[model samples]
Target chain A: MQRLVVLPTSRTGWALTIAFVAVVVAGIWPVIDLVNRAVLFLGLPLLVVWSYVLIFACFAVMLIANRVIEWQEGEDD
Target chain B: MTSPWPLLITLTYVAIAMVIGLRARGGRRMNSLEEWGVAGRSMGPVTLYLLIAAGSVSAYTFMGAPGWAYAKGVAVFYVAVYLAYLALVAWYFGPKVWQFGEQFGHVTQASAIADRYQSPALGALAALVMSIGSIAYAVLQTVGSAYILFVMSGGMIPVWLGVPLVLGCIAIYLFVSGQRAIGRTNAFQGVLMLIVAWAVGMWALHNATGGLRFGPLFERLLAEHGEFLTLPGAGGDMTFSFWTTSIIVSMFSFMPPVWTQWMSASSARTIRRSATWLPTYYVVILPMVVVGFIGIFSLPDLARADTVVLEYAMQHLPVVLVGLLGAGTLAASMSSSEPFIHSVALSWSRDVLQPLLGLSDALTGRLARWMIVPLMALVIAPLAIAEPGSLVMILLVGLGFATQVLPAFIGMFFWPRASRLGVMAGIVAGFLVTVAFTTLWPHPLGVHAGFWGLMLNLPVFVAVSLVTAPADSEVVERFFRIAAPRGLTRLGSGGKTVAADTAAHGG
Candidate 1:
């Protein structure tokens, strides 16, 4: 029987969790203020681009996390 | 007669939506609460995706978002930020929620929480509090639909007439079909809204800059309105603190309708996959926000910024496109409202009335189905007609109230030491603080009232739990065993094994 783990077991899962939190925080205040400028990056404002970038960053982290979850499920099965 | 085309097209769309919703039962019997409340928990990923995405987008995307963007500028992007975070939250929590629901016959969020803490009264309390938020949102969407029809029909369909006409149709379908109706109609409405958003966006871009390109228009906006591109926004009222804190509050708020959507999914994998792809659908918001930015140039100085999109469409777009935009707005409003309305009925009957009155499951389901009419007609529709002040403010305040339950959720999902008394106290304290901050102080120290509420709630919860006796160990263990069947491992410490000990086993 698989033992109940209170947190993610995989190193990648831990790293991804931290990274995802960082990415979300980066899209908001204080950290976001650094990039919240009037300048354009690839046709959009820097702040707007940063928000989109963070969104994709979150997607990437979650996708990897999904893989980890599936791997764990495989072990359980 | 003001060309009658826009009104005709919008009415036709409403009729089509009603047909879709009524037919969604697929000739199956919806005799039980499970079938009506959550589609028997059989929703596939595609429909779940649209239901969640469409429900979250709401009339706010069409009305409130552009209103904020037009009036405040870059500050409006906060909507996009929180929306992405909501997807991430669902991905993390969805599987656990689904597991518990499958194992323990949980059809509502309150039911799950109630089961975990072993308190039906707590469940009833949560149901009452969450209903407040759900009602506020439902009314907002109702008002939005009425506004769209009013504008589209050149005031021929007044707010009083329009509110009943459209909502009445949605009410009838919901009364008959339930979440199956919500699933089908959301998918249809989701597609229609996306098309309308893109069409309206591209047309606006072309008209504003003389080409179908955002680059030139954005450059022009930068050159002319530089302040709009940065923090504090055009209005400077949406401060950095306010913006960031609002996102934090929104990301955690346990909105009842969203929980129902999660429970409706076919599997944990379906929920995860749906959450994974839901972010991409938020691209719909971009075009709508752009339409607002376009408004700054095309039709500046509009009273009530929510009307920017509709006003712009009427003034600039072709008649057919205007009608299409009207249909799309109605879709956005109805798609969101249906689920919240459904959730209110389900939560009330199952979580509150059932436990209090000791009603049977079949009877509860029947009551929930019938409850939709009186609630919508008597409560929700009348509020919408009253036209409550500031859609975004109403939404934010509702979220503030809803997020008070986060402490209870933390206990259920993570901390076995957390007791029922602790959670109840925390929610009460949090609610009081939220009310005070929102009304009297108003974002004290520039932080959101919801966050401020959490500030008081967390400590009270931790302190109370530490000082008091913990919950029944058997109940806690049962929840953990199902929710984390493979055992949840610890995060950080390089995936090191810190013994879960009694905590894992629910001591």
Candidate 2:
């Protein structure tokens, strides 16, 4: 139990972890430069558009994580 | 000459905030450290949301962020990006921290770290570092609050008077209502700032572009000064490495005021819910950044970049809107200041003085209240009054120092092999490296000095832990049970495994 607690024991946990890591990497690795040319996407700069997209991604990931936790807690009950 | 109407409206706003804060007491006597420091752990998701959101957005959001946007174009978007990432961090870590607090009676981060490492002295060290950072930050906010009033009042209020006026209101409610005051006032402040941010943004867009739209503004900006639209910004100073490293440092560095907010949650679910929704609140930064971009063409050649938003507003907006802007900025300043000042006092009493003297909880709570006055009047107020130019630089270094706690956090939450000695060595070495790079060399090779410090810190931590003995397995397991509790039923069940608990219950 102790070991599994530290590492993700379930597939959902692993998927969330990978998604979160991808988000962090895309955020800080100059990946935005690929889309950072002097152009607008969705009425804003591409870089700015990418930032809000990441924000939306973050919200989606956390929402899923929270729902999983709720399900796990209910199962325990 | 500036009209006193703005000042009068701001004062009226202050009076309303005071009423809300005092009324947040809700007829409870805040006697214990748990009650006062963390509002008896009764805050729901909404209140917690407002408290954390408002406290995180400070005078920086009002002034410095826009200042960055005015000076460096896309680089300022890093604020929005990192802040969004911070919500993800809070989502992951906040629940675990709340569980530790609930299980072990840990109101302060230092106490939790101390218990995890079995080192009161390390807790003392954390308390000192966190307090210095908190106080320096509070001083900046106090100075900012005073500056807001001084500017909005056309210098009629003066810094000396404005400092006490803003800090004094916080102190009164903090002394009486404690975290409850912060929770309520922050909610009011959060709503106000959000409204003001959107209102000011739309108004600026309408007046400047002759229409209420951002497309034309972006077109004009890209057409005229295209360099400001991308990375490394207009001056070509904020490189990609610098931008990325800054976001990483700001995202990971644990602000102690935020910890107290986490502990004040009613349940781990509340913490998770609040963190999940927090990124949406960061949309407020979009308009404020727009206001900064508006300044690029509308009011150019500003001597001080930070004053661009205020200067533009005063020059262009009506008296009522200007007054609303002043109230919103003041709310931003005071909302953040209250929690920081309260945490400094709470940590000093509970983590520092209480442990050193072995004082009772009641006495510690009393001492925390007493310390607030001297903390503000003697330490923070004086430093803010001096307003030395170097303090901002020092504040930045203090923030850098905070990221050094990452190793200790890892030890508490994961990596059962992490030793107390290893954590201590890593933090001390990390802090020194951070100071050296930030002060002496300053962001060498375009990477943030704090990131460099962490680079050295992780290896040292691993090396020391490999050599040093690990903590007791049973105690470590107990912590894991409480922190993760994946298969366990409840946090308050004394760390029992589900199998054993079910069998013991005759299942």
Positional deviation of residue B402's Cα in model 2 after best superposition, in angstroms: 0.7
CAPRI-wise, candidate 2 is acceptable
In candidate 1, list every pair of residues with a backbone clash.
Answer: A4-B487, A5-B487, A5-B488, A5-B489, A6-B488, A7-B488, A7-B489, A7-B490, A8-B489
Off by over 4 Å in 2: A1-5, B486-507
Identify the CAPRI category of the predicted complex in candidate 1: acceptable
DockQ of each model vs. true complex: 0.45, 0.44
The sequence of per-residue lDDT tens digits that candidate 1 reaches over residues B1-507 is: 287888888989999999999999888778688899989999999999999989988888998899988988878888888999999999988888888888899999999889988899999898888888888889888888998888888988899998998789998889778999999999999999999999998898888888876788779889999988988889888888998898999999978888889999999999999888888888898888888999998888798898899888888888888899899999999999999999999999999999889999999989999889889888998888888676556666677878889978887766667778898999889989998888788898889999999999999988887777766767777776655444545444444343334444532
Worst 10 residues of 1 chain B by lDDT: B498-507
Best-performing candidate as measured by DockQ: 1
All-Cα superposition RMSD per candidate: 2.6, 4.3
TM-score of chain B of 1: 0.96
DockQ of 2: 0.44
Tens digits of lDDT, candidate 2, B1-507:
268878888888899999998999999887788888999999999999999999988988888888888998877888888988999989988998898899889999899888888888989899899777788899998998999899888988899999988888889888889999999999999999999989988899899989977889889888998887888898798888988899999998998888899999999999999999998898888888888999998778899898888998899998888888899999998998899899999998998999899999999988988789999999998899999888877887888889988988877666666778999899889989999998899889999989999999988987897788766666566676655455432224444434322322322
* Top TM-score hit: 1
* Model 1 lDDT, residue B450, Cα: 95
Candidate 2 local lDDT, residue B397: 81
